[model samples]
Target: MENKDKTDWRFKVANREALIGCGLALLNFVWWFGFAYGMGSRPVEEYSYILGMPDWFFYSCVVGFLLITALVIFVVKVFFKEVPFEEEEELR
Candidate 1:
């Protein structure tokens, strides 16, 4: 036998938002891991120094950081929706 409640789970918008956020988070993690690992594996002598750090560190840690920062800002501004979660009323 199946049981149902007044709140139909299928109509929830939060699930979709959560899924998109989790997907983006996973993508960001992969991006960081791949670049940082690729850069870290190279010999120290092969990379030129930037700000007293290896070129790989400079690009992977510093520049990649800036790119991700911009990406987050853009996504938050353009893609993220302002939705009232169902819990707002319950908390009061």
Candidate 2:
């Protein structure tokens, strides 16, 4: 009797995908935080605008959302693999 769970390849794929997801999430957060705090620390009177939006808000919220969305789509198409959920029977 061998353990099938330990030998499952899907687990490996799932874990790799999970780590990639976490990494992307962290990257998005860092980007948002850096832009929001770094550019927004100045006084409101000194704030700059881009396309009718504040610089910090434009870059941190709008741009970051679009960038992360594209990155997630790329990652899913490139790095993520499709694994079947049904249990496969062992061959005798």
Candidate 3:
């Protein structure tokens, strides 16, 4: 194929993967910062300990969110290679 077509395909694939990564990161951020914290009125200290753990257990949530997002992004980049529109016909 032409060199321009090859370049365009590479560009499109890169953009598609980047978009996916950004979306996942945003979702993680919202879940951890918005849903978890927004609903809570008082400080974590006001709550009783759970199973000997402190009420301010939100640090774990932050770390877990980061780890999960990293794994998801890695999996998306490794297993999901995007195809250009022109190549769709070849799949048939």
Which is the winner by TM-score between candidate 1 and candidate 2?
Answer: 2
RMSD of candidate 3 to true structure, Å: 7.3
Span of ten consecutive residues with least summed lDDT in model 2: 1-10
Full-model lDDT for every candidate:
0.71, 0.96, 0.63
Candidate 2, residues 1-92, lDDT tens digits: the string is 76976588998999999999999999999999999999999999999999999999999999999999999999999999999999999887
Against the true structure, what is every candidate's RMSD?
A: 4.9, 1.8, 7.3
Candidate 1 per-residue C-alpha lDDT over 1-92 given as tens digits, one digit per residue, 9 for 90 to 100: 54456464534555776776787777767767776688778786676788998777777778778877887788778866676546534333
Measured by TM-score, the strongest candidate is 2
Candidates 1 and 3 compared: the better one by lDDT is: 1
Which candidate has the highest lDDT of all?
A: 2
Tens digits of per-residue lDDT for model 3, 1-92: 55675455667767877887787777667666654465455576575554675433453375546776687968776866856556334333
Query: How close to the true structure is residue 92 of candidate 1, measured as C-alpha lDDT?
Result: 33
Clashes of 3: 0
| Model 3 accuracy (lDDT, Cα) | 0.63
